[model samples]
Target: MKVSPDGQPTADVIARVKDIPLYREAVARGHFPVLEKAEIARGFPDNWMTPALAAALDAGEAEFVLSTGTNHARMQLIRPPYFLLKSYYRLWSTHPDIKETWEAGCRRVSLTTVLATEHVARVNAKKRGEEPRPDPRPADRRLDARTFYLNTRLDPALWERADVERMLAEMAEARQAHPQGWYHLDCSGYHLAHLLQKINKWGLWDAFSPPASIIHAYEFTPVNVRRYLQQHFACPIIDLFGSTELGYLFYSDRRGRYHPYLEDMSVELAPVTEGSGLFHLIVTSVRNPHMPLVRYRSGDCARTLDGTPDPAKIKQFSGREKELLESPSGPVAQGDLDALVGSVSPHVFVHQLRVLSPAEAVLAYTTFDGRPLAPRQVAALGHGVRELTGRRCVLDHRDHIAIGKSGKYAWLARDGK
Candidate 1:
């Protein structure tokens, strides 16, 4: 069966696969070898390289482009055509509870870092005692209008209290200009939350208008920060889950439950061990025509709350396969520890958790750039870990918890020689 250039499978193709003996046989074996065969035939491009994506690029239908290196290294992805993104817009605008607080007709104002690339260049220029050159206007400015390239390597010292206050003032000005306006923020969750913490710590919250909705799309949001934003704004916080290779696949409802959006994608959970409940995510997606992926190992672990494939019942998108800690007792996901720490103290930003002994662990975290954690807060964090994991952990405040060169935080680290 062949897929169309636009990623739509033809009627003949659908009919052929509807009763194909190979598909039936594969399903019976709890696998999809035919899809794997097709992927292998196509050289197994990432799942995001679908036929629709190629068609969109070929026809110049994409609007915004985003780059992500979170998993398989840096690569660009085009946002779906306006019509497709509008579907997402509609979902938010028409949501019953959300629509009441957020005005539907107001145009969105995007608040992001200024001169994102120059931020890095300025840092480099300072070392050489030279001024950074102004960015040249591209010949095709329209093509670059919606493109935002953030230099993720900026020094934390630059984003001080004054810089945070200036951003809040801008947000306030935007709100005053359009009283009913909605804000559409785009940035890494960690960066945005860090900025907000500075604002709060500096007493700037009352000066700015609360955003109608907050969308954190670029990276995984630490659970505590999500709760804080929701509580502070009293508005819905939306999270988009997908990769550059795959278009947006899931979105959280107002209640923060993820619902799959891919009608052509099916998910299966194969237990890592008998009765473990933890399982590997096996996906068979027919969405990408140019490069289809069948029975693909997404390298993520999850467990169904009710032990079934009902999308609504999927309780947790646990952790990356490689990040799982295999101890003598069993496998423990990093996400579990993240939740435990966050629950203990919302102010704590744990960058690494090291197990020092079977019953003891050490937490290394940065308290807003050497701002010491109160003794009671540190104790509360330790107590929370003991309550959650039954492991007594010593909380240590550090000058800084190093982000990986890749700009990701590793939550857990095993003791090494």
Candidate 2:
């Protein structure tokens, strides 16, 4: 069946869905329902396995992989090797703001979770029996000839002076390796912020090399973190929104305006709750030929500039659907609270909203400089929280916040959970 310019099939795409065992029964029932994770995991690869797919696997044309489990439990998936990296490179080479750097053959230095770095090392090793040798050298963590990994710890908040120094030295080496002495930085925005804080504390600016361009595609970066990066780096800071299952679908420009990159995909947004601005992202894509997703609920949420379903107007990829919270006014998303906090103070780095009771909550936060927020800023934050959640909020300051077991940070939690 031929697909339209917008990715909608002119004929029934269900024709293809019916071929897959997983959706055969649903198609036979004459009802094409939105696919969820539980249903996909019901029969494992047997449901999706075909003679041709098995042949592809045997020939090493496709492989099994697991999702990062950032927002939920890990999900098993099948795709061609380097599926995500190809998607990333396609965007980087064509994005108006970053194409010049990409075409220049710039080196990439990734600084994100240690889990991500370790995953790269494991994949590169190609052996699963024993753990890869612990090597602090960049060559051991190199993903490819053009890309290298930097961070080796689970949490950025716990990075010591030696950690900072080592990362800076490795980054300098990466920059020097480039013919132009410029390298591209790929990172989680939170990790970059932590690095910047440590660099400032130790006055290590000379040891670090500013990238020609930067992309933060790992997680939901708070608004303040983006602004903080702007103050330190003159390069373009782009935001990419996508997942492991689906390659990157959209990316932002230097001005923070998002543009769709759905070459073989389409997206629809459903309201998280009636009359609420937040929306759940439902995607249908043939990007991954091994496991084509049909109207898959991606478990991610977003918000539109005008609170409408226009994909072009998608202003923010807010947070995960599982992490959403309830309030008297409406549902509260991670981005909703992040915007409120950013407005109160740019000094706030990491934060978590702990719901104490139906009528009370606490906003715990840590500053960039290990100092508490001003009294006025704290009071403003409390007022803002109360207005947003219909609960009295107590502001608490701390020197550190913990990373999650998944190697990401949680923006909202309840009762120390």
Best by lDDT: 2
What lDDT is reached at residue 252 by model 2? Answer: 100
Worst 10 residues of 1 by lDDT: 136-145
- Per-residue lDDT for 1-417 in model 2, tens only? 233454343345666556789877776776556789987788889888977789989999999999988788888999999899899999999999999989999988999988888887777666545567676456668888888899889999889999999999888887888889889999999999999988888899889889999999999999989999999999999999999999999999999999989886878888889899889998888788888887789999999999998788999999998888888888899999999999999999999999988999999999877899989999999999999999999999988889987679989888856
TM match of model 2 to true structure: 0.95
**Clash count of each predicted structure:** 4, 0
- Residue 143 lDDT in model 2? 84
- Clash total of candidate 1: 4
lDDT per residue (tens digit) for residues 54-149 in model 1? 666688664333334444434333354443334445555655545553454433333323334443456455556977656412211111222223
**Pairs in clash, predicted candidate 2:** none
- How much lDDT does candidate 2 score? 0.87
Question: How well does candidate 1 match the true structure, expressed as C-alpha RMSD?
Answer: 7.7
TM-scores for every candidate against the unseen true structure: 0.67, 0.95
